[model samples]
Target: MSALSESRNPGATRSLQVVATAGHVDHGKSALILRLTGMDPDRLAEEKRRGLTIDLGFAWTALPSGQEIGFVDVPGHERFVRNMLAGVGPVRLVLFVVAADEGWKPQSEEHLQIVDVLGAHGAVVALTKRDLVDEPAIQARTLEVRGRLEDTRLAGSAIVACSASTGEGMEQLIGALDHMVGNAPRPDSTGRPRLFVDRVFTIKGAGTVVTGTLTGGPIAVGQEAEVLPPGHRARIRGLQTHKRSLEVAQPVSRVAVNLTGLPTSELERGDVLGLPGQWRGTSVFEAWVRPVRGLDHPLTHRGAYKLYAGSAERDARIRFHGASELRTGERAFARITVSRPVVLDLGDSFVLREAGRQQTVAGGEVLDTDPPARPGPDPAARLRARIGLDRATLACRTVIDRGAIRTPEIAVLAGVTPEEVAAHGAVRLEGWLVAPDVLQGAAGELSAALRAYHSKHPLRPGFEVSEARVLLGQHHRVLSDPGLAEAVLGSLAASGAIVREGAVVRLPEHRASTTGREDADRLVAAVEGGEPTPPTVRELVAAGFGPELIRAVCADGRLVRISQEIVIGPTMLARAEHLVRAHGAPPGLTVSGFREALGTSRKYALPILEFFDASGLTRRQGDVRLLRAR
Candidate 1:
């Protein structure tokens, strides 16, 4: 009977999970898996002759608990660390193998570090070769391994001593697997499937077959897919999960795809097959880097490094921002300029290896998938907000940050064209698409600032355009840019949350003060209420009120402004509209004809007539003005 049967069911069918084995060369990771599942992970003849795993080996078994588990047996030699990384990238658990006789090893530490960087957090530390070591030695070695894991993602991992030769503690290891598998996270169904090709080979009659751990979403048989970077289209002719034929393979599970489109020679390691339209490979991206564990040195700026993300490894350079060098144990922002295009999602974890060093210097996650060549200053701070915000909110914040971003930049943020962004409920001003919520947030900001200003100076009616820009910039850096701030203000005005008059902005509730209000009332009284010609700004300013107050009255909708000087109150505007309606026809009233009809100077009447034409209330033909349908 398979040793897997020695483990008992927890009473129900359990979760499916993948776990990788990592340790030093010839430390019995393969033998241990062989003992546990009765299947040899080492499939290569070269590895069989050399007695070492030269490549990743796959095996699986069903525990008595009915939990189906897959194992990716990774080569433990330092030379195959990249191969090891590919196996460990998508696994939910790491079965960290530390031989009891061999004790702690360097390659084991490297494997754990890669696991941490890729965020495959949970681990089970196996003290293998227990039969070769006495109890005291086994306990000491187990404690040493535990000490190595302190303050890490695997800090709380269960440690079990097991020997493939004598089977000592094998059941305990399987029991631990049963207990932990239930807590492993299921695959994300974000509707975008990604299978980073780790192995590519041809099958008897199945054509080209590629295998990797599936993630992000599901890949079903007969699904249309594309190989990224190369961007060759394909159709999934067949699907296999854990060696069993499947109609659809879910994420976090190992999958082998039979594809039709490109030949087997065209595929290679590090190629990604995904749902085509949702993603594109980019050569440049931004990442927020943090130093590796126990690395007590700063990272050099503009240094070339080897970066491993998913199943792809590429040559990359770090362009550190705000610092010449990144100090050890400190977080820094940097742009990852890759030699090859890679399909990366925002927040995907990656490991960075120094060019000439044996140790990995740092690791980070992609912060921006397609960042501008020069990300604006304080990019890390801006990116952090986006991590928690929805795409539209981030797009809006991007506009706020840099005043305005162009269509291409908007495409980077919104994942669509600026026109598409607007079509999907976002607001567009000029050429910039604004987050619908941003408009409200900006209005609230303007309203709040105006409210504060009113509280400080009750006599002031509103914020002058220049003053409003200052206050907006003070409220949010994005608001400080005149173009974007005006866009926000313009949106607010359109929504009627604030009033925009001449060169001033204010909340709808704000009004000119006690003296200014009474004087504006008296100025309107002096204008003939039923006449076409009205009092001018010069007359109002000479009477008592200032030009500023008169402008404020016009902005607050108390008066109709005809020109710089010619103005009329709402009562007189009603009489002038009455005269236009009295001649409302196809060949309406001409400027001179209206002037003669109103018995007024052309200076006042002409501006009023022009205002009517411009307002869409009347359409003029040569010298005639026709009233538009109400």
Candidate 2:
């Protein structure tokens, strides 16, 4: 069937990406790949003459079942380990190539460690150059390699002896790869299309073009896409997979796209192309990094490094939390702050190299693409929080449990296809959805806290909204969903769970008792009879009342603290009434004038004036205060 026909047919299964071949220099990796795919992957003349791949190469083969399998031929040289890492990020299967004559090499082991770190779904070992080794020698070497792989994730993977020159085991290698591909999971086609740009250049007539194995979703000609980090939008003018022009390309297929509108200067090999606004450049992320086993030095904080992910490379600073130094081969949670924003999703694989030395130090999976700003205290706490959310479903639930999880954040944390998470629930394209239970639980906690607070400070008018946020801590912003919090507060008030007095929140019982008490009565009497002066806290306390009770009365609006020694209750009402009648309107009163009017000193007058400012009884300007409208 035509590629397009196979993509559309219900019975035709999606293809798989099988990344194979490893070992230091001249292992016949390229030759074996050429024999399998019948396509020369080594296009560079330097690679042809040197008989080794210096960069990543791609080739494809159609299996007996009509399923297409793409292979990523990565350089085995120690210097190009970064290139190997870049190619492994999007692959599901590994074709580990070991030369029978050369046995195992350093780069081969390093490459295998990288494949394990990347979490390849499956693997097949090719013992190439079998013609150079006798049958017994080949068998012994293959067994030794198998023993070495026993403790690894690729332990039980199929191993086949082959010679690219004689093509002895070519059919067997194809069969093994095909079998693994059939079992590999299919990529989700739903969501945003993201192609990690592995190769970028201008075709003779196609303008700026980029090629990479389609890692997620599908892209079609004429579809609009955006280049990330730099964030330039463009349209797909052409599409090709496996060197054949096609209308559309699906996941696991090697695709080259000719783009329009984006200048060649604006595009780069690492820049990811995706549906506009589907992905974002991330500055902060949480990762569970493992240092390469058997290294002498420990991973240190603020250590500069080069980070590689899906054909993208950038400089970054690593902050190792929970410990000052990460021992060689030790695993720890780390926060990576990139020098600039890069398009990254949750579960994406990344390699870290020592900044200037360019040696692979560590590699890890992304846990969070955009983590909340965390400063001070134990950095390990943030790491643990991320570690607990390693599972996709649990992570998704945690986001829901926390109230709102951004779609992009969910995609980054779960490592599942972005489209799958986006389809799991109907969330606002920009805002996340909070589960009803989470919202209800937060509201309940808020109400209980307010009630407890009112019980402790009966004289206080209510709880301020800002104070409530401080008390809630991490749940603060999650609950501060504008009218949502207010609605909960209102519900509590209506149910007598709490009382709302302006901006203050109080217990219903406390508001009633404080306002009806005799201290309130005595305060009113003292203020009205004492030459229009307000009663102070001390003066009110002397009248068989506590300072707390006096403050409560003032907060209830039955009395006002006009001065330190002079508290007014219904007394300001009379003065306000008199002033309005005599002057047509109340005049602006200075601290001196307010003191004279209340017959108190400046010390007593200042706080009372400010109290009026808080109550909206007067507006302060410079040193003067004006009576406010009722």
Candidate 3:
């Protein structure tokens, strides 16, 4: 099947977004949403009777501009903060509800802090239950809420008054929500999809279905995906966004996927749905964090806490730099060594709460999701952080200078999106980062070596391509990247750096010469004048010829070494070559014919013919020899 048809949905290709509610308990978050959306968020009858949200609830509303916005109504009770955080990461704009009657409560302050640390772009503050208070009281509460929001991302926000019972300012709240949706930035959908599965169940005929906000990328029907942490691969048999079947669901949309190949009993709410092998469990990462204000005890180094990011939660230990006790309201560079790996990206906001009490302690943005250096106060760690802040060009240069870097390593060091890294030519994605020039340089060196080899041994064929690769120490795959390596070799060949001879390579313009040229000439003259059987190396050396001269002539194929004592020049091979050419088989010329032709004795004739047979130039057939075909 085609990749798209097998993996993507044909109908669900639209952008769906998430908006969440933030406020103190009993601040009228659910009621205000009920007034604006006309859908009751608090589904449980007990919750409705108690006049408080005890669990997370989902609601949908259409803005005045006709844009659909989903709301995650989280419990504001301090005890249920975990549930509140579980729904926060996927929200785009926050509906920060503050009661005009109550002003700012503890839960109100904490919820605002959560939104601020989450780096929410925009917010519409719903001043709920305005009818319960007079005008002066409303003004006083607005000022108080404003004061509490100072020095936060949500400091400058639109506050609209509304009453769930009478609907005093529902229209203004809807308009503000519409404005927020219009101005909110869209989430990136280029990376692997990470769906934080908050709910899972089996619907009789639907098999197993899991639902959550799609935080990262698009997911379609028939896609082969995985549930992370446990790493189970499953086919997306179906997908639904806001209860409607879709071909592709975009980022920030609430999606329910019917998955095949996994039993409903094996999946859990905390597990993430992602592309297979796209994310791994990580135990350590560096973060920039600020402590909560007015804490009785300082944040100790190696202090354990509950870490929440995206859909994954883990118990992590915080290791602070230079201070054992982290003071309240203090910002510092800290490392959170998690107990397990969760899908996270650079700049992803995370909240850290005290492990046992589950109280919010600190929160920060993810600077490096897959840091290489160990988390500590060391020079290498500092260097890594500095590199993490560099621009793409500079970062690419740094990695190239270092020789090789993996994709995850580059993502962490550059603090850039992995998609950006993949898109940029800054690094070659051949399982590692290598300087494009280095690969080119190695190829050039190999070609140069080949040309030099050919020039020195002009009569012999060039060296094999395999030998050149060994000298270059580059893999065959590296040589296959288009003109990456080949272009370099071509340049070297053009510049007389190397010579290409069939499958062999050699050096250009190289020749083998001897210091004792005269002595070598005399030996050649005497050998040619006498029988074709050449003299031994000892005899040639004794006859006023040095060993170096003999070795050089032998290396150039001018003299062929049959044994330690036996040697023959190109003249003897020429006769053998001629014999093979004349009679397709050398055995046609018997031992007596070979001896008579070379004017050599029986003793020399047998050894010469036998040497030719052993060297594959000729083959022996019983008592005679046959020439081998070229």
Candidate 4:
């Protein structure tokens, strides 16, 4: 079996490596890959006819050291720069090609700028067509290329002079690639796999298939995945890497997935496939951007710009921090608003191109994908503090900023796992991770609302829970979510900061106080003297006993308010229950029968029975009452 096929076995140990090519048009990028792998990098019919690369092409080969690596050959024409970025934007290791006779050209400079912005993990620069140049000419061209690499991330990358036609220096070029691939760092796997689809096509019998670089984690066959932007779900029917069938595709390698659920009509290039809920899409985000070196004009908010990241390209509008415009070399914080929602994460690099001018202008690292609606004063400073923070610290700060957030939501909002979020030591209540100060503030606000409620309705036992929800909703936006709102109130109760009773909530110190007031005693006396048939609330109000005092007496257990109009003494309530038990048998007790037993009219007896029914003390059957078993 071939080396690429061997890696697909379960016991294979060597991880696959990927390399993307960068250079000017017809500078032997495709030619070098064809010479190295014995497979043509230019796959399109027009590309072979015109002797030019029009789009991205793929080829793979085993290195001299038995390491399997793949090459993404990209077009070097300025018009196809979008396709070139799609190839190189996600891969970290680069194989830069420059013709020895022609030296550095315009597209050469532009491609280098893109590689520098994306920040390669390792690179090998190939100076092709060495047979066309003299030894002195080759040395001079080497020095010219070295000048451009002085401060770039690819500064120390080896530059090999070779000829794809004659195979000059081919062995040295192979050795450099082997060394670069050997030392490159492994891709971090967080169990959240993301595949940015660069090419989408339907197979005759395999259905829809998409090819892209897999990162963040491994994707196994039969696992469910979601296609983002529209978020249609599908199952992975099969997996392939370098045209070899595999049960699972590893990260930092090229992968093609055959999906079962969604059709090719629904998916397109730039769409993402991942585990459901692993990625969140946002149109607005904050970033730290710096212009590319040697721009002829200053970078301003005005211009038709396109933002490129992974395989996705979006129309974007940018606003700078603390300034109206930025010079060629100045760096500043910026807020980018895309034309539509796209999946972005922290520290992901993107390139900005001025479409009107048809040139790449700037590149930036994403600082925050979910920025605040109104960026307050010195928002730049706030973002700067977060620039170098670890994931845990950033998750804690995000929780603090949101005051109270759903625990699982951190994974969706910031890509921080639940365990990482828990390690920060934030307070979690009812699945909500809350900031310490915000929790304290929420308790205080609830207490204040209860106090106001008690003062306004001193006769009431406590604040009604329904009203409390509405009142708290006005104070804290978190209260608008029913689950989160109940969580806050429950946490306060758990901490003994408040008390909850059935449908009401109250401060711990609250009480229905009519103590030592003359109206309280008078109301009780009037209710007791009236016996089974007590005076109506209208009569009590007419006698100068306010409705508030009557309600206070009722709340104090001195009186039972049977209805809006009827108020009875506690003695009367007990007497009615006794009569119901005595007469409640066989046919059950009727309102008139209880009325005569209590020596009251039907008007008072009807409401008395209803109050008993509401309290679960009795069950009503049509017009008769049945005694309930305690």
Candidate 5:
């Protein structure tokens, strides 16, 4: 037998298929499994004593073609329907059992509806108790089962009559199952592993153990994992499949994970186990739903509904789009909000059951995990655009929907890896993924803001950096966050949309101009005439000279800025520097002596000396100033 081995590691198995069993109570599903695998699937003592399958049992067998198949034996009693849904939710194939004498029963129809909703990949019907019926009765039961399955995902399934008690036709049933397993398509491995825990128990020295069908990818022993809802970290101490210890467990197979750092009381059934930061729980999502074929009334928002997905079930409320209720056989997009958060992704299938009546109501396919808080009119248009898209495209679309998003946020919202999101063609600004249209719109708004800034303060060099950030935040809400706003500015600067200086931002073509302007000439003349102690900024603003014009003349070198409130002509600044150099060498120039040399008062001299000190032209020690060495 050829073991399904990973190419990277020659001795390691890469693939294992799991098939779940479904049928009516006491229909010989468990007995048939024992006959085929020679191992009893019923484990609980109460179940064995009652002679009815309860909870979930698991077994495995190797096929003739070296393919290993694991079986999840689900209870068929009406009372244990929740257990059955949990077993079959993540699985894609089934071995449907039906008693030949009873034909189709109540639980059989309900289970079949679930299988159809889940879109089972392939199936084989085991018509059990064949020894109790004649050849004619066997033919009639086969026809009835086939007719019922004609409209389901298991329509083309092969039905083989068998009796687990008498071991009649067991060989033929095994061959039929082997053929079905050999041709089944492989499960998707998206590099994000999620195991919806179905059972949590603790062994003496091993600590907590959780069992479920692992999907999405492979999980290795000793890997770091996380349990959701409580959202705590746990390490995988060991892994097993069908009682055989494995270094790594592949997707779409039954797995028992021994986890450390979490108690059994904290981790329960319906919780999720996954790699840290790879999964996010959401309480509300949007999906496309269809009611069952024979619903007695219209499916409305006012019902006690429970949603089943993967292995988790939560109380849910449904609100249809463009309508208040959904009629039978009709499909519509709807928003489903659950009482508790669940980890779901796009294209995931879920079953909705009316809890009061204990009957299945509708089934749905998830379209969006993180939907808008208020869906505007005709929201279905947005969902329709998302149909049939791959993960990368969907991640890119998420960026478009939100205007700009970080890579980590894209991974969480779109259910893809960071690497996958990075590989897309969208514009990447720093750590944020930006859609092309959004980037273009931001560029246009920034350009317009810069133009307006230049027009309002014509003499200034540029708009202030702090003010530019405010404008960007106002235009794009996504950039309101700390680092994201800077990323947008950087991208704009790099693309020549604007130029960013130390304290200001401006259009590339903008420059501070004092040429042929009456107001600029007047401001420069006023600062030049004020000599050593010029009119302060407050005085200039009070004297009908705009502060922007005062700063502009200073920025253009027509006037020198000695302090926030003090400005002087370039000639005055040069004179002050020379007077300080001549004030001479060592124990430094005292403030009083320099004030006398510059022919200025103490207030003007102090600010000039401090400005020189700040500009690296001089160093101050106590009240003395020393000229810096050239």
Candidate 6:
């Protein structure tokens, strides 16, 4: 409930959008923003004295469509990029400034990388200081700037040459912005929001104020919210959107929240405020990472770097997966163990920096914000593979980046239902749901693993069913799911690609029927040619057959081993079974009675009776036993 909506009579809803500025130092970004918004973006005395933007500034204006637009004016210097990201990260549209007098420069390239890495929709290029350069020079600079933007998300954006002093070509810039606001998605009205704290300060009247872009859902006045990372609880004493007091602040709007129960000094620029259970602070997570172009060297495992996410910057240690070293041009799955607690969302885009070099090395999209504990297949293997946004319009992209998701978390992640996710090609497997591509890739990896294992050890019965799950996990993470792996292997078995024999899984062509002509004949003679009872395994070993070979033959299903010292042919066991069924007493089938009835001594009789019980063929009670129900 916005203050207007909660008023005596609410009128038709109106939309307000935000945009940020980015460019090289001295590119006249501040000049352009001031010309359009009628406010000086350089508020700090140091910035005014040095004629350089050392911090972020805010201003706003109305477009021709009567849409109120806010501008987050960011610093153009490379040293202040963390501050620039704090501004641009919360806005979708950008006013990319390039001074015609100086042309493109270094910070321009770095700022543009941040734009692409953060996943902004589109930007409008502003060729500033056109008054200082000639018409041909302006045209030449425009061509150069567009060429630099090639292969980028904003390559196709509209560019207009303008002079803030003369106000030339201002209307064209307004037209481009109007088109963006019309096409930009609307904010979600759901009452769950996470405000990334960018600016925190104190006013005499209001105890403490924190401001950022309100995303995920809506926040109402008097709503209880908690500061994350530290999880300090607070109450929303007041709310302001675009600097006006509002009872409720909607998603995607620039919001300033009056908070109680915490001092302004305790709250910093990187803290997050949200309702309980909607978000949590985490120190470790995983993402699908891609190194940016032109890196001097490879990104190796366990390398520490500076991570810039939303408005927060923290030192992070990277552990590359799929490979120990990530090639510069390749994308790989990696885990990041940060030194600080940060609120992360699935599919959030972030920029990582080599702090010593002051250069951005790689950027990635998060795959799992809340990962399940990966207790490795072998507890000792220590599989260290510990493997945000937005309101309504921002919500859909969040869910897609999240990969495998649960049904209940959909509403909080994307402001939609499970049905909506399924309609978009997500599939349900076991207890979780994942995108179609996840299932496809997992199936392929698991199938390939089975082929590899069979090729290496064809003589083995097959891979143990449990070991198969672990082997697949060692390669691709998504296939380690027990239920899904069971389902996949079971499906493959039904399709004849593999065979399942109790606890073991093997290729369909694998068999346990016989070892060979030599071993089979010897085993048959030993059991059938013997009188009354078969030779024990020790006697067979003494006769020249190795223990392993004899055991393999016994396991070949031609004979049954009742105990370490007892072995019997399957035919003889059937005769003994028939005798027990015909004469073994229901009144009391004692061990002594079975030994005499089967014409075998007590040594073989008790072990055979125990084998029958172990196989569920009979039951033992007190000093007697009886047939078990089938």
TM-score of each: 0.66, 0.75, 0.67, 0.78, 0.80, 0.64
lDDT, candidate 1, 1-630, per-residue tens = 112112332232222578888888878999999998898999899999999998999888887688788899999998888788777765658888999998888887877777777776567888998999899998899789889888678888899999999998999998887777767666555557788888998876667889887777777777899998888999887777665566677776778888887798888888888876767888988878887787777788767788888888899988877767886668878777889998887668898887677567788877677675557767767666656655555555555544456555565344545665555466777656655565666677778888887654445667798887777777655567687778777777888988999887777887766876677667666664635556677876787768766665676667778887887877767777888999968667888778787778788787888888888888877778888877
RMSD of 6: 12.8
Error of 3 at 624 (Å): 59
Error of 6 at 552 (Å): 28
Better of 2 and 3 by TM-score: 2
Clash number for every model? 3, 13, 26, 0, 0, 3
Q: Is candidate 3 or candidate 5 better by lDDT?
A: 5
The runs of at least 3 residues in candidate 1 whose Cα sits more than 4 Å from the true structure, single-residue gaps closed, are 1-15, 386-433, 436-630
* lDDT (10s digit) by residue, model 6, range 324-406: 88766787777787889888775568888876777878888776554446623431122222223223323333333444555
C-alpha lDDT of residue 528 in model 5 = 78
Write one digit per residue (lDDT tens) for candidate 2, span 1-630. Answer: 112223332233244465656666678788888898888878789988977788888888888978877778888888787777667766768888889998888877787777776677888899999989899999899898998787677999899999999989888988998888888776655356778888877766568888886766777777898888888999988777775666767776777788888878988777888887677888888788988766678778857898877777888988876777787657888889888788877677788888777677778888767665753376556455655443445455445545565555555444454344444442332345444455556556766776776655565556786665554444556556554455545655676766677777665665645544555576667766764444456765776677777676666777765655666656555564354234323456677766676565676567666765776767776666766767
lDDT of 5: 0.85
lDDT of each: 0.76, 0.71, 0.71, 0.85, 0.85, 0.74
Cα deviation at 475, candidate 4, in Å, is 3.3
Ranking of all candidate structures by their TM-score, best first:
5, 4, 2, 3, 1, 6
lDDT of 3: 0.71
lDDT minimum window of 10 residues, candidate 2 = 1-10
As a whole number from 0 to 100, the lDDT of residue 139 in candidate 5 is 94
**What is the C-alpha lDDT profile of model 3 across 26-77, one tens digit per residue?**
8888877777777788878988888878777887866768788888888999
Off by over 4 Å in 2: 1-14, 188-190, 375-382, 385-554, 557-630
Candidate number with the higher TM-score (1 or 2): 2
